[model samples]
Target: MLWGALPYMVIVFCITATIWRYVTNPFSWTSKSSEMLEKRLLRWGSLLFHIGIFAVICGHIAGLLVPIEFYHWIGLSDEAYHMGAVFGGLPAGIIAFAGLVILLVRRYTARRVRATSSVGDWLALAMLIIVIVTGILATSANAVNHSGFDYRTTINPWLRGLLVFQPDPALMQTVPMNFKVHILLTFVLYCVFPFTRLVHMLSMPLGYLRRSYVLYRRRDGAIYPNQNQEQQKERAM
Candidate 1:
């Protein structure tokens, strides 16, 4: 039931909740960065986490979305792909996990941040950690240890088919336990995504490019005599 129904259910919920949140409380849909409360750990953690996540996302897109035949046609063997996945994915996962730990610690240890953090924040962190850990386990078990369970054959088709409304639950029957767990957790993450700070991931800052320039001035209203004279001359002109 989970393999067949959960993905679609989560997709609908994610879309509905995201739209509801935007319509109801659009201004609250932000990351709510706590940089002012603590910067040192936040700086390192944010940088490493974002970099690792970008790499991990790219790796997933290549491994899952692109068919294995494309790699073969390009003169890339399965062994080469497996080795690259392990070598590249392991480090990226480790880095992201480490940064998440730092961020978690900072969130709890920093007095001001802890006070300001909502329950949703902690829930998001917990779900992210679970998903990342399971993903690492799945990647390590299959790619690093040579488990002979080529996910590209089974999982790839299942996932792609699911996207096109052609889910074949039988394909997941032969899949390993760790991979199944990772996939399930990912779907669960999507279910909770719209309610958490993860929603910020959907945002793009294109507005900043066209924003008006901000001008600053002294708080005091008093103007210098020479400046006043210059302003008056310009006004007269």
Candidate 2:
């Protein structure tokens, strides 16, 4: 299973990266107002998406880094674990889902936005929706599947094994196929990440914010004064 999954993952990443490298160059894709709007959607969508995504990533990293025993040693009972997992996962899932919905709606509902969107854009959003929805379902199902087996116990060992090229199938088997599909979809998404507009994820923090701040300069070479400055000064007085 690892062998089968690993190669495709690598190939996907390579293909995605190559495509993104070419496409993201401003010179490659020509547009004026359309690009501007895409940038706008990206700004808002990315802020929500990246914060949620980073939280999810941090949760995953925490799962890998902190052993179940550590939590247990610290007095985290099963109930506590369940509560923490539910609270952490649910909000992250909702944020990701909302971000995707906003992006998709912008793509289809806005005339210029829809025209500017490509087939790849649609595919990326569809793939992300699948991954996020499946993940939410998997988390819900897990609550139902709590059979006294401490999932926390297995994560660190599994991650250690992954680092050393020895992923334990037993741990993998413990995860349901639906969950497995969600994991696989995530892998596929990563492989394709560099290729899609999803590539914006990597560039988002810098690109998104930079694009949002439209600057203007005065003829005297000073930055243009904010129109709100006088209002703020009056309010302060």
**Local distance difference test scores for all models:** 0.88, 0.69
Provide C-alpha RMSD values for all models, in order. Answer: 3.3, 6.7
| Per-prediction TM-score | 0.91, 0.71
**Per-residue lDDT of candidate 1, residues 1-237 (tens digit):** 887888898899999999999999999899999999999999998888888888999988888878878889999998888889899988998898888988999999999999999989998889888999999988887765767988788888888888999999999999999989998899888988998898999999999999997655454432433346675677577
- Candidate 2, 1-237: lDDT as tens digits: 553357455766677676667666744332123546567675666667767777777876766667777787988887887788779977987787878888777788788788877777788889988898998887777777765544466645665666676667577666556666876787777765655655544333466765767678666444568546665566577
The CA root-mean-square deviation of candidate 1, after full C-alpha superposition on the true structure, stands at 3.3
* RMSD (CA, angstroms), candidate 2: 6.7
CA shift of 49, model 2, Å: 2.8
Worst 10 residues of 2 by lDDT: 26-35
**Candidate 2 lDDT (Cα, 0 to 1):** 0.69
Kindly report which residue stretches of model 2 are placed more than 4 angstroms away from their true locations once superposed.
3-35, 38-47, 148-150, 203-215, 218-237
Candidate number with greatest TM-score: 1
The best candidate in terms of lDDT: 1
